[model samples]
Target: MNSMTRIPLTQLDAREPKSSGPQQARLPSAADVPRARDTQFKDTHGRRFSYLRLSITDVCNFRCNYCLPDGYQCSDKTEPLTLEEIRQLAKTFAAHGTRKIRITGGEPVLRQDLPEIIATLKQTPGIETVALTTNGYKINQHIDNWKAAGLDQLNVSIDSLDPQVFQTITGHNRLHEILTGLDRALELGLSRVKVNAVLLKGHNGDQLNRFLDWVKTTPITLRFIELMETGQNPDYFAKNHLSGESIKQQLLANGWQQKIRSKDAGPAQEFDHPDYQGSIGLIMPYSNDFCSSCNRLRISALGKLHLCLFGEQGYDLRHLMKENKQTELESAIRHLLQDKKASHFLHDGNTGAIQHFAQIGG
Candidate 1:
């Protein structure tokens, strides 16, 4: 995310076009990405994976309703890795062909001296982009430091514009405060700011158009998220399951026409808006099932690497790191690749997120 290295524009949230003249060429979809027997990264057709989602910590400020419900028995906030540890890990992943790394957390800003962590990762060779996911409650307080620390773009989780709904969702009344933070992120020349809204059936689904209408004014991209089958959900996903098709119908009712195809990245399928300055993103991982082109690898707070998000298994990398056993780490990674499951059958079945989404990186 260092501006000196990459453009420092948001990698995960590319809502706005850089030019005012006309829109840039549309990005190719996952299906459009060329298929070959031997891709550039490795000999296998699969695992040409260049993206990695790194969870820096599991501590968050607010205990959101959908994430960890009331009286939810959660573990203590996870300990973040040292700067040296993160740099070494990034280097190893880069050597094994990972170009993009998105640093996530319950609230990564809670980690002491996040700028240093970001700077170290930015300095790592082969890491093309360094993005983050935050709640935006504390973002305004740390914007200058974050920008100075090599932080690139951001995806702020915002469920509702209504103050009461926001309070109810996040278990705190910071609705106006979070909106201020979003304004601050845009003011800091973030270039791209994607507001991720998790839609529940009866709760905030009614606010979809109202929220989208407001997002059209600013440069930030607004994305609708369908609640996944994670354990820590509101009423356990019973009260909140709004599919992607439902979201599309709402968008169509609002007169949002498709601009073109979305980039071959992220879970969201983005759409262009004729009336708005920025675009809308639809992340229907539950409905559309983008698992066929899913090439993501997740690392737990305890340093276990997971090949699939909803997969029940993960190989412990903490043991190897603690024992200074580098060979075992590579062996574990290879084993995961060899035994990777075809797709996560968790939509109508069991999602067994292994741990809560708050514990894992978003």
Candidate 2:
């Protein structure tokens, strides 16, 4: 482990040590501020935001080409929010009607206390789902404990089915471990285990048939994500970027049929194979703009609330937490929610802050 990624034991203890009851003082009521008429996290545009993606740490073991640049440096300058802090933060959001929470990271499982963290979030009154998005490297060791800790769903990133191709893309040769972990998760009766594959034009593009073949053997959903501009090498993105449309056409050509449009909370467009037990999801951030139905708010590891993934600015919740003012925290969150950007500028020709996906928590 890198020195910068290590959390101080004292600070961890201050996070209200696990055995103790809820460490955070009860949130002060926001009675003075009139509750917004519709949904809690909704903005003026009528978009009801319920999903919150919280990144537990910015340190990643693998330097995936699509998410981080080569020779990327992890900053040890700042301490990430402690688990107790995340608990209080989730409480604030749940109080405001955010029901679904996805715990993310450079790799969430890298955090030793992640199972306990999931248990903490699950204990939150209004939090209905406590899901996770991981690289699947270390999940096998903790799968059973995590499920026992109240983890509801999982989204594991498997860049390629071929070991050599996966090694080239992720700069890691642990494809077998990831696959084994996924198998264990499914066998454990995990209700939803979505395999996320980032589609690189000429790289793993040839393996779609194999992926579909594997899907026929399982009930887990497979999601293909389009490579987007995430501040990595522009040359790399331009060369590897595969549009969801092309992939969709390929799927249709292979006999996969579109499923009826149902009300889904997230952005993936769904398609299914009649003979298979599972379905396929295409996340075309580059080809299709799903911001009109965006219902997510992301909190980076250091405690900044990012309203839009590509938005340039974020409100600092860590500072408010330090101040220990619940009313002010809730007020600031609402103001920031109301000021959420109407659309993401990630599409071609428009660019905001060029951020690495690690910093923003993918």
All candidates: CA RMSD in angstroms?
A: 12.2, 8.0
Candidate with the greatest lDDT versus the true structure: 2
Per-prediction TM-score: 0.81, 0.87
TM-score of candidate 2 to 2 decimals: 0.87
Least well predicted 10-residue stretch by lDDT in candidate 2: 9-18
Overall lDDT per candidate, in order of appearance: 0.66, 0.76
lDDT of 2 by residue, 1-362 (tens): 11222222222221121122223322224663467675376777878778899999877888887777463576465777798788888888898888989998777877888988999999999999999999887777888999999999999999889899888888988889888888899988877999999889878877888988899988999999988775455777889888889889988998889877655457888888889988999988765557777888888888876777776434456756543666677876775565566777666534444357777676
lDDT of 1: 0.66
| Residue pairs whose backbone atoms clash in candidate 2 | none
Count of steric clashes across candidates, in order? 0, 0
